[model samples]
Structure formats: C-alpha cells, structure tokens
Target: MNSSPPLSNLLRLAAAMIIITLSVYWMIFLRGLLVPILISVLLSILVSPITIQLEEKGLSKIASIILTIVLFLGLIAGIIYFATMQISDMLDVWPDLKRKGTLWFTQLQNWAYRLFGLRPQSQITKLQEMSMAFLSGGGSAALLKTTSTLADVILIPLYMFFMLYYRSFFCEFVYKVMAKSEKQRVNTVLFRICDVVHNYLSGLFIVMVIVGSLNTISLLILDINYAVFFGFFAALLLLIPYIGVLIGSLLPILMAFITKDSPMYGVGVAGAFLFIQFLEGNFITPYIVGSKISINPLVAIIGLLLGGVIWGIAGMMLSLPMIAILKVVFDHSESLKPFGYLIGEPVREESRRVVEEHTAENPELITDEVADSVKEAI
Candidate 1:
C-alpha cells in the first residue's frame, strides 16, 4: 500500500502559522504609529452624533467637527494641568511618603511574623537589597520609559485632529466600495457596531466620571494627599473592563496606605471602589448600555488577554470594542453566525416565536389600535 504524502500538508500548515505570526507581530510593531490614529478615529466615531446634531442646529459640518476637536483638546489640557499639579505635590512629599511606607511595611512584617511564627527581619533585609538593586538599574530605565511616553503624548492629539477631520470621507469610502447585496449587510453591521461602541464608550465615560468624582470626594473627606491624581488615574483605568477596576482600586488604596497613616483608610478606599463598581455594573451599565452588545464573559476575558499580548496597554484598552465589532460581523454573516452565537448572549428563540404567533392571532394587536393591550399582555 502507498503511503499518503505528508510533506505538502506539513508545508502548508507551517506557511499558515508563519503568516499568522507575522500578522500579529506586524500589528504589535506598528501599534506605536497606528494606535493614536485608531484611538482618534474611534473617538471621532463616538462623538460624531454630537457633531451631526450641532450641524443640524446651524453650524457647518466642518465647523462643528472643528469645534468638537477644540473642546476635547481643551478638556484634555485641563486634565493634564490638574493631574500635573497634583503629581508635583505628591513628588514634593516623596521622601516623607517613602519613610512612612517603610514604617508601614515593617509593622506589617512584624504582624505577619507574630501571626505565622516566621522570621520577619530576614525578609525585610531581602526586600531592602532588592529595592537597592532596582534603584540602581530599574529607576533609570523607568525614567527613560517616562521620557518615551511623554513623546507619544505630544503625537496623539495631532493624530486625533487629522483623523477627526477625515472621518466623513473614510465612512463614505467604506459604504461606496461594497456590492449591492453586500452593501446593505455591511451598512447594517457597521451601523450596529458604531451604535454599540458609541453607547458603551459614552456610558463608560459617564460612569467613570461619577466614580472618579466619588473617589475624590471620599479621599478629600479622609484628608488624603494626591486625591485628585488618584481619582483621575482611576477614571482613566475604568475604560478597561474587570481588570481595570482592580487596578484603579488598588492604586488609590495603596496611596491611602502610604499617605493617610492608617490601614483602615486603605480598606475604606477599597470598599468604596467595590461599592461603586457594584452599582455601576448592576444599575448604570444596564440602564444606559442595555442589552445591545452582550458577549460571553469567557470570550471577553480571552480577547482582553490576547489583545494585551498583541499590543500592550492600547491593545488592552481597545480589546472589548474590537471584539464587539467582530462579534457584530460574525453575527450577521451566514458562515460565521455559529461563532457569533457562541460569543453572544443567550436568547430564547421559542419565546420570540410564541410572541410572534400571539401578535398574528390578534389583528388589532399588530396595529397601533391595540398597542396598549399588547404592551399589557407582554
């Protein structure tokens, strides 16, 4: 018996893997350039309805777009100025903060030793040695990293401006190139994607602002230093999903521990975050975002991890929206609908069919004449 040839299949599989690897690498490597543009475009899309509304009110489209950009820029500038002042104040008291942190850690070590019958002094000594090594090498590296970050900060706004300016043309181009049957499908999917993204971003923004303001107020009440900085930092991180809340909550609690001289204050800070996130997830998000873009929690987590691996912070930030858009496309396509169903929220098809049948049985219910009756029955 002749054995089936295996080399060709192996070669094809190898080529496919290589192509996928290269595509991932390309996305990551070009993120430095593409990220700003992508962020700008997404922001523009989010705010486009406002721009259109302004135009309807008498302003030209170009004028409205320009006004929107300027307003956003001014808001950004104010935030930067406020955060800088707060951070500067924090830095000015850094030596005192460091001393307090060391004392707190020492106390924690002693407490742990007392409770667990472990040696605390040796662990503390090892920590000191590690800190010294980090200061000698990691500190300089961090400073260099900060410098590079500042450079990107300067570039992002410029990219945002140009992207917003050309947003209309880009949208038109997307619609223009598709065939008739494909065009309707593409347009429907695109509109749904845009709606979901816009709603999520806008709703999240509002939630963050409220949560951040609450955090700031709580910190101020507790007489914590850098309250504003921590509040804003938390708000920014709130743009990410489940992981963002943890990070946002941890930073403020740590700051409370370091600056307030009370472990209770740190606990209080964390408690406040937990409470706010609970309210937002259960109440605010449900009301504002509704059931539009529901995806499987497992898939969302996987997407976030994959995005982080591919594009670091920006990837993590954009991951959900990107997955959401993909879900929309998959849901609308016949071939890929099964994948979409796997990622989507559960729906009761039989219940929908029952409703349709009920509506068909009552002619007046199908019309506006029995709208109230239909609503009451439902």
Candidate 2:
C-alpha cells in the first residue's frame, strides 16, 4: 500500500553515489604520481595491435614492444628538441615583442580616449600597480611551483617504462581473477574498452599530425617566425579536446602579434586553425574513429571541467576515456543500460533492427542476453 520508494534501495543508491564521488576525488588528488603511468598503460594498450602484428611477423614480443617504445620516445624527443630550438629563437626577439606590445596598448588607449573621453592612462597605471603587487606577493611561489611541475614531467618517461614492461602480465591477471561465468563478460567489456580508447587515440594522433604539418607549412608560407614551435604547440593542444585548439591557436597569434607588429598574421593563423578544425570535426574524426564511442558534447565538457578541477592536466586527458569505459560497462549491464543509452551517441533504429535480425538468425547469441538481462534487471 506504500507509494514511497523503498528505504533500502534509497540507502544503497546513496552509498553507491558516495563511493563513486570519493573514488573520483581520490584519483584526482592522491593519484597524481600514478597518472603518467596510467596514461602510458592506456596508450600502450591502444597501440598493442601494432606490437602484436610485429610479433606475428616473427619478431619477439619484447622486441616489438621495444620498437614501439623507441618510436614513441624518438617522436617525443624530436618534438622537444624542435620546440626548444624554436623557442630559444623566439625568446631572442622578446625585447622587440615587448616594444610592439607597448605600442599596441598605447594606440588602443589613444583610440579609447578619443572615442569615450575616458582616461586610458589611469587604467594602465592601475594594471601596472596590480602586476607589481602580484609579482611581489606570489611570484616567487609561482616559480617554485613551475620547478615542481618540471620535475613531474621528468618522471613521466620513467613511469612509462615500468608500465609498458608489465602491461601483459597485468591484463592476464585481471582476466584470471574473474569467476568462470563472469569471465567472458568481463573480457568482452575490457576488450571493447581497449578498442574504444585505442581507436580514439590513434585517430587523434593521425589528426594532430595532419593538423600540425599543415599549420607549420602555412606559417612557413606566411613567413611567420617560430613556425615549427607554434605548429608543435598546436598539435599538443589537440590532445585536450574542444578547448585545446583555441588555446593552441592563441599562442601563435600572440607570437605573430609580437614579432610582426601586424594583425594580419594573427588573422591568417586563426583562419587556418578554423579550417583545419572544421575538416577534422566534420570528416576526419567521424570517418576514422567512427561512432563506436560517441559521447555527448555536454557530458564531455562537464567531464573535462571536473577532471581539470580534480586531477589537473592528467585528469582532463583521461576524462573522456574513463567516461567511455563507464558507458561500455553500463551498456552491458541490464539495470544500467538506460543510463548508457543516455550517454551514448544516438542509435539508429535500422541498425538496431539489423542487429536483432542477426541475433535471431543465431539463437546462441541471445542465450546470455535474456538470462543476464532478466537477472540483472530484477
């Protein structure tokens, strides 16, 4: 006769939510040391197909793994060297940039004074005072923080090494611990997760290379200084999802503004970035990555914000992948499938019909579905 929800069910839901929130917080805060290693492992899993193919072609597993690691390291090293050289050149011209920036600000102030009859000089003085105050109060601590960040960056490669070495053993152990009935299900979910993450990363890598190369070439044609450095920075930003591209573009534009004393260079840079992003979003990504792990844009943005708040850069990087994994698990579980559907890309009814027809043609495929569905749903 009671119309209210069960107290036991409410308590269980509350407990689950609390646990999830705490786990996320812990991963964001305490797990900073392990983040790079985790990222390496995730990347290794995604690229394992290439390693396995090499092994199948007669190379030893260790040799294939070593080759993969070497290639990754070499690529990273090359980017760093190129970026450093270009940045050094850019820094050599900083005095000129500062002079140009001052001139630009002065012109802006003049324009504002002419149009609005306001004292632009007062605003400039206030800004200078605030900057000086900040430098005196917090700038030393900021320098130490920067140094600590550099130390973390140095540790990433070392973390990567151990993760790559033990990846296979870790995967095997995970599989071994599951009960017989749950083994297949767990394996299926894990494999799908790996596939989604791998495809996503690989597609992103290819896109970044294309985008970076094009940007570099465009800058060269435009006679922009530090073209290589800006190109590489743009490519790095592609790893950050939606906001990364904008941030990436700003750096080169700012550099152009400083070095050339011309707004046209900045305009050109922005235009090129827009074109590239359009191509990537519309054609490249969808075709290469497919709809296998389509996440809602809102969810992705929220995930990114929350990740940034919790784990900083690493959290931002892993946010979407973690969400994708959660979606996969929810899809496979009866009680959670509705939640999965909500997070997933729109499903085509025709595709669903096709899958249903295929399952009908092979009854064995439906055996686990009904049993698992009924048991879990109830």
Candidate 3:
C-alpha cells in the first residue's frame, strides 16, 4: 500500500520553508548592520591565535587584542598604500594608455567592418551612448555606495576588538543557554568551529600569496606593465572565489590588447590567467588550503549566488566561510545533521566502511566524543 506523508511532517516542512524565507528577508533588510558584525566575527576568529600567543607571553587579554588589531591594521594599510601608489602611477600614464587604446579600437573597428559590414562610426556612437547612459545613471549611486563601504570598514576594527575582548562572555552565555548534559558537546562544537575557521582562513591567505607570486612572475616574464599590481590585484580578488579571478584578469588583458602592437599579447594574458586558475583549483588550493571546510561544489555555487544577492561582493566573499560555520552548527544538532551533510562533500564508501568497522569494534563509540573523532578522521 502507498502512504502519504504525515500531516505533521508536511506542516513542519512548510514552517521551515516559511522561516527560511523570513530569515533571508531579515538578512537583506539588515545587510549594512549585519555585514560588519559578521566580518568582525570572522576576523576575530582568524586572529585569535595571535591574541592567545600574546596572552601566553604575560600580556593582559586587552593588551594582546589591541596589539593584534594594530598589527592587522598595519598590514592592511601597507597593502592599501602600495595599491594606491600603483593606481597613481597608472593614472600618470592614463593619457598614453587612452591614446593607445583608441588606436587599437580603431583597428578593431576596421576588422569588424571588413568581416561583418559594420560601420565604425555607428559602433563608436553606440559605445558613447551606452557609456553616457551608464555614467549618468550610476555616478551618484556609486558615490553613496563607496561612502557606505568606508563607514563599514571603519566600524570593523571596533567590532573586532569588542568581539575578541568578550569572547569568554559569549562562550559562557552559550554554555548557560544549553542543557548541562549537552555542555561538553557544545564546547567541542565551538572549538571545532574556531579551529576550522582559523585553518581555512590562514591556509587561504597562504594560497593567495602563492598564486599572486605565480601571477606576478608570469606577467614579469611577459614584460607586462605594473605586473606586481595586476598580479596581486587578481590574487586579492580570489576572495570572491570562482568568478573573481576572471574579473581581475580583465584589466591586464585590456592593457595588453591596447599597449602591445598585436592582439596576441591579450590572448597570451588570457591564457596565462586561465592556466593559473587551473593550477589554483587543482593543485595549489588542494595542497595548501586542503578540505577543511569540506563544502561540495553545488552548495558553494548556490551560496555564492545567494550571498551576492543579499550583500553583493562582500557577501560573495563571506559566503563559503559562513556556510562552513553553518555546517558545523548543523552537524552538532541531531535534527540538523542531515542539512549539514547535504551541504558537505559526499562521503566515500571506504570512509563509511571504516566508520562501520569502528562502531562494530566498540559499540559504545557511537557518542559525541567518538563521533567527532571519526568525523575528524574522515
């Protein structure tokens, strides 16, 4: 006999869907307020190791946190200063670049006309019209957006300091909120989350540096202008994951096309970037970053899309870490374990067999402590 789902189950599913929808709406509504806080949380976790080490060396917690924050800010300021200098240099040569680009574009128009019977004047007119339309529509909006972004950036350090200072208080609050029986498991989960975030972030930064160096060397070999700037620019864009490198490649490609005599230089730039991307995905990332987050590709792509919709570029950059954190939380909850697994990498049969063997050897090992140990092994 065929059976329908229970009404209670159906009602529960409906409630979950409704709750998820409302939560997304709430997130979008509070995007500005939430983004900085979320960034602070991640940054705090990432640098907590430094704070801990400083505290171990006899500094007060507050002093350690402040020192860590200062070091972090100094690093960021250095990078920004260098990037700004690069941009200034590029601007200094902007007239030359523009003239060269115009000349190359004329050649492109001639080729287009010869191949497709298109008019160069019509093409130029259409481009001008589109450019004017875009600038006129977006200029004020872009200014406002930039101002808001600066505000958020200023708020991040303050938020991070408070978060790091009050870390114990938050842990205590979580312990107090959960049942005493669940305290040990909750603590384990918290530690796991922190460790995962720290490892993922630190490893990712290393991978970025390696990738950036490779990009710079390739550009230098090709004698590209501002090789360091463009190389690291593309590397920093790795924060946004899959599409970011492509976006970063655009400037270098355009520069090559405009500044070089032949369009083949642009093709060379494109091929170099694509090869770097391939190496990053297959070798560098796997070797350096590893599978600490363990998220499947499908979930990652979907999370990226959803994050972009909610908070634009920052959201996209934060999406994977946020999803990884959510998966950790879900893994610790019995009712939510399936959801965690849904977003995580597929388990192999060999891993499943190993787990089964462990359970068979020690039937009592089906506990939180044992489960986490097994999960770590996998």
* All candidates: TM-score: 0.80, 0.83, 0.92
Predicted structure with the largest TM-score when compared to the true one = 3
Ranking by lDDT: 3, 1, 2
Q: Estimate, for each residue in 1-378, the C-alpha lDDT of model 1 and write its tens digit.
A: 868768999899999899999999889888777776677667877877878788889998678877887787888899889888888887898999899888887788888889986688787788899999988975757777577677777776666666666766766787786555577787788788888788778877887887788778877887777777777688778677777877877877877887775689998988887887787678876666545567777888888898888877778888888888888788788888888877765543233346667777876657755653443232
Name the regions of candidate 2 deviating beyond 4 angstroms. Answer: 53-64, 115-118, 129-151, 347-354, 357-378
> Which residues of candidate 1, in runs, are more than 4 Å off?
1-19, 57-62, 116-121, 128-148, 220-223, 259-262, 347-378
lDDT per residue as tens, model 2, 144-178: 76776677667765565555667677778877875
Clashes in each model (backbone N, CA, C under 3 Å)?
0, 0, 0
Highest lDDT scorer: 3
Model 3 misplacement above 4 A? 1-4, 132-140, 347-353, 356-359, 362-377
Clashing pairs in 2: none
- Least accurate 10 contiguous residues by lDDT in model 1: 344-353
Each prediction's whole-model lDDT (CA): 0.76, 0.76, 0.89
Better of 1 and 3 by TM-score: 3
- lDDT of candidate model 3 versus the reference: 0.89
Q: Determine the C-alpha RMSD for candidate 1 after optimal superposition of all C-alphas.
A: 4.9
